[model samples]
Target chain A: MTSYSLILRTAARFLLPLLLMFSIFLLLRGHDLPGGGFIAGLVASCAFVVYLFAFDVAPVRRMLRLDPRSMVGVGLLLAALSGVPAVFFGEAFFTGLWLELELPRIGEIKLSTPLVFDIGVYLVVLGSVMAIVMALAEGEE
Target chain B: MSLMWSTEGAGLLEWVIIAAFALMCLSLGLATLRLLLGPTLADRVVALELMASITVGIIAVYTISSGVSDFLDVAVVLALTAFLAAVGFARYLEKRGHGDD
Candidate 1:
């Protein structure tokens, strides 16, 4: 078990949510900007790693609420499924599709198949990295 | 790159940015030296953190010099990683019974 440090614990408590939010921001702005799913996933994993450093594996596992390996499987499924919708439209696999919607309060929203693919990538990266890190940390104990 | 060297249209702000870049490079070199020569693990980790921070500074400076905001995201990611690296090192040191140091 890792020894507790008051300062590190406090900082990790605040940083985890902020880092997660930034990762989402990176994921969302990735299409037209210099952000993307891969980097965002890394950032998110870093957030959890920070939490793990301050606390322990058990709490971190509880917070996650699912096995990291399962996350990788679900992410892979989502990535494959994201391309299936294009096949329904008579397009080849992995073809980009877009839908634009206007909601009353939210104004305009542009949805795309690429976004789904990015989310899948994010999940895969986050899951695999966390699983590896968690295993290593637990082994250290 | 050419903009930094060209004296034709350089302003005070550009000169300051160039100076900032020079200072950052100098500090980066010093940090690298410390990382190579530090006697203790903690010193090496601190040096590494310093190098990470200087890299972030370089990115920020480059962003200002080039008038592109996109690179700021890279800086943000770098900073986050650096923070994690520092925390991880601290945890390792504590585990090894060197936390007081």
Candidate 2:
């Protein structure tokens, strides 16, 4: 992996940001559009995978401060907690709740508990994938 | 008869998706063959990766054909994890002979 050509490294330098943005776009649009948190998280983690391919795992670990295993737990907690609010409101668990807000630059934005759930799924997927990739990469070393 | 074709007639997008699906299936078949016949572990790993990628393509084609956008999530997840499988195999190969002691 470290012996990759200079061309690939240069290409990745530009491609990484574009891939991240596309993943975020997928995450945001997932509620109403073709994109969603699961796919977006996969895309985001793959972007890191691409980075790891071009470089290595140490920098990626540094960039992501927390352990990937912890990320998985945090994601699960966030997803479960997203449903708890609805339960407290006398709604069934995991019921979708919505909030409408008007922001200056973004204009009208709609938020929902499902979106939070999706975000949690995204994080879990990303973290788990990275954990596997990192563990394998470490073993190789 | 454009009207008649509506029932049996394929739209451009439909045709494209169908063509892509066929190509993916073809590749998947070839990958499967290689996976079965490969003499080396590395060749088998490559074939496995190819099959996984073709599966992703099949999922994408199904998404378009069925007009179900959510399957894209499945495709993305598959694509992401497929690489991990590859990495894991590679590591296993690295450790196979050297660490036996």
Candidate 3:
């Protein structure tokens, strides 16, 4: 591997967390807001890409454990689950519902089917981005 | 393509979307070039990743432009399916037990 150690280490330590948070923010605010799950996931995955490029894909994969494919499956399941409620409510498929829950500590954290959908979106994005990357990375190896 | 995009006229939002789309196209193109010309396999993978990011961005932009949330589903599937495949391949490489061979 090439030596650019400092750049790689710094990116993993400092840059990745911020990137992940930004991704979440984008996913959460996506409905009626400026961002969504797909964009957010890519942004988050970019951080991982930095890690993969800097160190190597093997260490990172081991560190994360559970192949990215599993996450992809989970994401798909979650997204589909999010839509099921619509059918139960006598609405057409994917009829999104927005609700709110008032919590004592965190105040009112709005919850909705859309948010659930976003979570699924986040997972899928995270999974797929990693999927393509790992495949290409290994192909090269 | 311009005609389709310009149906809404040159509003600020329209310009922004257009610019963003153009930028994504450029990035994807750059990544494709790298994938084609890379001296190493890893470099090609990285380039492929860069391309994927742009593609996802384009999806999001289109979803927003259309205001039809239905498009979001497509974006979700694309992101998950493609990324997972990448992960599977990575493990196959790691399991080879060939670390330094």
DockQ of 1: 0.79
The model with the greater DockQ, 1 or 3, is 1
**Which candidate comes out best when scored by DockQ?**
1
What is the Å distance of residue B23 in model 3 from its true position? 18
User: Tens digit of lDDT per residue, candidate 1, span A42-100?
Assistant: 99999999999888888999998889999999889988889999999999999999999
Could you give candidate 2's per-residue lDDT for residues B48-94 as a string of tens digits?
99999989889988876776677887786687678657755664676
TM-score of model 1's chain A? 0.97
Clashing pairs in 2: A30-A35, B5-B9
Tens-digit per-residue lDDT, B1-101, candidate 1: 55655666667778799899999999999999998888888899999999999999999999888878789989988998898888788777877876433
What lDDT, from 0 to 1, does candidate 2 have?
0.81
lDDT of 1: 0.90
The candidates, ranked best first by DockQ, are 1, 2, 3
DockQ preference between candidates 1 and 2, better one: 1
Residue lDDT tens for model 2, A1-141: 335547657866776797789889899888767778887887888888877776779988997898999999999999998898788789999888899999999899999999899889988999999999899778776
lDDT of 3: 0.74
User: Candidate 2 vs candidate 3: which has greater lDDT?
Assistant: 2
Q: Sort by TM-score, best first: what order?
A: 1, 2, 3
Better of 1 and 3 by lDDT: 1
